[model samples]
Target: MLWIPATLAAAAAQTARNATQRRLTETIGTAGATQVRFLYGFPFALVFLSIALTLSGERLPRPDGGFFAFVVAGAVAQILATALMLAAMRERSFAVVTAYVKTEPVQTALVGLLILSDPVTPGGLAAILVATAGVIVMSGVGRGAGASWRPALLGLAAGAFFALSAIGFRGAILALDSGGTLIRASTTLAWGLGLQTLILTAWLLALDRPALTGSLRAWRPSIAAGFLGALASQFWFLGFALTTAANVRTLALVEVLMAQAVSRRLFAQGTSGREWLGLVLVTGGVGALLWFHA
Candidate 1:
């Protein structure tokens, strides 16, 4: 299959994962929910990474100093981003949270350009602006008079952390000297997930022992969320390995549409006019980017 289709599938899977996460949050609370997902998902990630390594017939390489640091940083950033996102979800509508999350593409591109020194064409810049405008519209930024800026600010922070995580993971993958792509990708994912589990687990225990204990006691629902989260991360890593972070992040905007569908069905709310317009703009922007790049 083409990369586009694969990316679309990944985006769809990510959307489903987000919906599951949102549901998980309702029962476990945001922090507790995240702790459960990461803690439970850690083992699954190890298993999947091991399976990928075995199938590829590649030996895992010992990560160098830089590689280790990158993975650890990425894992930490992802954990922070997820925590912020879940918090935002608790405070805002699903549509609002998703629209903010879609800003990941823009943040990723900018970070890649500045930090990684990735080259950007004029067309790419234009696409970024258009997509950003779409996100602002979808967010109802100025329309909600007296609406607190907390959600938007929190969402943006989450997106920024997510961008950092993406950059960190990609850096780790590139730092690996392993000849096998599958092995390198899997190894990076394993380390990242492992680090995330450790850090988040420690943080939860230190600050919120009761929530952590509650989540552990009610492990049934958390198991599914954990499994789905691990599965989604695997696909996300695969896509990142195959394409530039900018491209993958841009395509991942499909998650917003998927989230919208879920919100409509599960939450029984239609999109606002601004959100509909924003969706159109975002679609146009994404199409423009794809066409220009192609």
Candidate 2:
């Protein structure tokens, strides 16, 4: 399915974005780094929406109350999730935090089922559990620095928020009355970014002016992070448009593997034998998911 490739692309871009934001967080603080994604990313999202509209030859989908509600919920939840994710990264290795966040698929499956009526077949549920187990294994739960409960809790909280965001975004996409999948997904991405940018901008301006100004002063790297963030969100929304959020999120667990690469290259973190074993499980679980969905 198109969603498969879209999810993969999203995962790759997101890993890059996370690496960039991780660097930014050191200088700008967590709030500033969090807002960098939305503020810088909003314009790029507009560009993506325009391209999708032109390619699809579709008008902008008119939003009703349902669209606004869903988009707002997604926007807020994602803001919280990003902040928590970055905070957790401050305490743990990049790969570990990535593995922690990958736990969202199960939460996403449940939330998507309850909130959006998105069904998860028994096979899909089993695959999700297996993939999630791989994440726990990779994270080396109860071992080493990762055993610290503070970062673990932050990561888990981030996963829960991410789950809510995925469900909200999928609901928003499905709520659209007109336009093809590409256009609808693009439209939703634009709205979600706009809302997030506004909310974070206001918060920064009001309470964290230094962090806000810090992000502005680092415009060069901020632009790079923004582009990557927008790229990730574009494909993520595309996947959500094509299938249930659970399927998209489960496929997205591949990001942990990608993040491991980033961690080794950028953070100088090495994988253990246990992590390698977990890698096989993640691969198997993702393979099983793809087969089941197919």
Candidate 3:
């Protein structure tokens, strides 16, 4: 399905965005870096909307009350999730934190089921479980002491928020009264980024002017991060428009391998044999999901 390639592309773009955001976090602080994805990304999202509209020759879909509710909820939840993810990045190796956040697929399935009535067949449920178990294996849950657990807590918390955000986003896409999949998905991307930008901008202006300023001073890299973020979100929304949030997110687990490659190449972090085993499981689970979907 189209969703397969869309999800894969989203995963690749997201990996790049996450790497950029992690670098930005060192100088901008977590929330500051988090806002970069929305603030700098919003303009690109608008561009994506324009291109989608022009190409599809579709008018923007009229948002219903349900759309507003879902989009707002999605926007806010994603903000919290990104902040937590950056915080977790500060605590652990980039790959490890990513593995922790990858747990969101299972959580997304549950939340999507509860909030949006998205159904998961038995095979899909099994695939989700297997994939999640791989993430748990890669997370090294029982390792370390004292503050070592902090990253795990933060990452899992981020995963939970990310799950909620995914459900909200999928629901928002479904709420549109008209427009083809591309138009609806792009429009929702614009709305979500717009809300996130406003919310983060207001917070930075009120609470942390310096971090906001820092992001601006580093705008060169911020723009790159923003573009990647927008690109990723656009594809993610397209995938959501085509399938259940669970399916989209479960397929996105490929991001774990992408992150691992980045970690090894960029961060010089090595993956243990156990982690390789986990990767196998994750791949198998994703393959199973695809087969079940087919």
TM-score of each: 0.94, 0.98, 0.99
* Candidate 3 TM-score, true structure as reference: 0.99
Model 2, residue 290: C-alpha shift (Å):
0.5
Which residue runs does candidate 1 get wrong by more than 4 Å? Answer: 1-3
Pick the lDDT winner: 3
Ranking by lDDT: 3, 2, 1
Candidate 1 residue lDDT tens string, 70-124: 8888888888898898899888888779888778887888887886676667887
lDDT measured at residue 219 in model 3 versus the true structure, 0 to 100: 96
Q: How accurate is candidate 1 locally (lDDT)?
A: 0.79
- Kindly state the number of residue pairs that clash in model 3: 0
- After best superposition, candidate 1 residue 159: deviation in angstroms? 0.8
Model 2 C-alpha lDDT per residue in residues 71-90, reported as the tens digit of each score:
99999999999999999999
Q: After superposition, how far is residue 292 of candidate 3 from its true place, in Å?
A: 0.9
**All candidates' lDDT scores?**
0.79, 0.93, 0.94
Q: Which wins on TM-score, candidate 1 or candidate 2?
A: 2
Residue pairs with backbone overlap in model 1 = none
